[model samples]
Target: MSKLSKLSLITLFFWIVKIVATTLGETAGDLLSMTLNVGCAVSSTILIGVFLANLVTRLLSKSCN
Candidate 1:
């Protein structure tokens, strides 16, 4: 396969994976807050922690590069 084709296929696969993961996360979040009674406040705090961790990792990676 050509390099372009391979790269395109990889990109498409990554996009599909991202979509599936996002959907699963949303569903799980609702289930936690509604069914498990986790509450929006706790969920939001957890999500904020995740966001901060991701932001820090991205900043560190970019600086390293």
Candidate 2:
């Protein structure tokens, strides 16, 4: 598993991506809701769509051995 228990480099890469994605997502959500004056519901829906797209790609990828 590339030197870590059931944790390959590819898996680690995805993990980093997921973390960064969520971090940016949080920022974007806040900006949309507060700065841009978008309502919470609309911001939430937009974030949900973004999360779902990431979820799809994550699900399609192979898991670590």
Candidate 3:
């Protein structure tokens, strides 16, 4: 018997998108807190709220399947 791999093109695309988005988010966060003088606490709170809102929206949305 041979083992089969489960990874597909769609999965690979999503993984790439996730990595890029995470890197972008981190860079933006650093810029906001450091360059813009927004302060870590304020920037974090704003970002966290945005993240939670997106999470809830995605969770409530219907699945493609």
Candidate 4:
């Protein structure tokens, strides 16, 4: 009903989505690198990309605040 309440619900939904998505990504990454033999380099690169994206977002958010 209120603005803060709406924002809280949105935040909770995003947190749940993120948890599921992260779990799915972990499973998919293992399947690709181990089951499909995609190699460690490819899998590591994918992980590094995720890390860098998070780092950049954190930096940007901190600067905005």
Candidate 5:
């Protein structure tokens, strides 16, 4: 119930979400590469751009904390 405990719980949840997101992203990128007949380097570059765009959008949104 303490602030420190609450913050730790939130931090832990964020880390869990991050891991899941990265795993999903990696899987999707590989699937996309195979479907598009692209190489790993190209696929990674495209995925990175997509991820960054989403991150920027999310950070800039008014609802973001």
Candidate 6:
């Protein structure tokens, strides 16, 4: 008996999007805290709040399938 791979096009797309989003998020965070002089503590708090809000919204949303 042999096992087969389960990777699909959708899964690959999801990973690509995740990587891009993560890179963009880091860049934006640095810009906010350093370039804009927003201060690290405040910027971190704002970013964390946004992340939590998005996470909650996604969790509460219905599945597309």
Considering every candidate listed, which one attains the maximal TM-score? 6
Poorest lDDT segment (10 consecutive residues) of candidate 3: 1-10
Return model 2's CA RMSD, one decimal: 5.5
List residue ranges in candidate 3 displaced over 4 A.
Answer: 1-5, 8-15, 63-65
| Candidate 1: regions farther than 4 A off | 44-65
Q: Which segments of candidate 5 are over 4 A away from where they belong?
A: 59-65
Name the runs in model 2 displaced over 4 angstroms: 1-7, 49-65
lDDT of 6 by residue, 1-65 (tens): 22323456667789999999999889979988999999889888989999999898889889843
Which window of ten consecutive residues has the lowest lDDT sum in model 5?
Answer: 28-37
Model 4 lDDT tens row, 1-65: 99999999999999999999899888878987999898888987877898799988988884765
In model 6, state the lDDT of residue 64.
Answer: 48
lDDT of 3 by residue, 1-65 (tens): 22323456667889999999999889979988999999999989888998999999889989943
Candidate 5: residue 12 lDDT (0-100)? 100
Name the lDDT value of residue 26 in candidate 3. 94
Could you tell me every candidate's TM-score relative to the true structure?
0.61, 0.55, 0.64, 0.57, 0.64, 0.65
lDDT of candidate 1? 0.86
The superposed Cα distance between candidate 2 and the true structure at residue 49, in angstroms, equals: 5.1
Candidate 1 lDDT tens digits, 1-65: 99999999999999999999899879877877888898988877777788799888998884765
lDDT of 2 by residue, 11-52 (tens): 989999999988998899899999999989999998899889
lDDT of 6 at 45: 90
Residue pair clashes in candidate 2: none
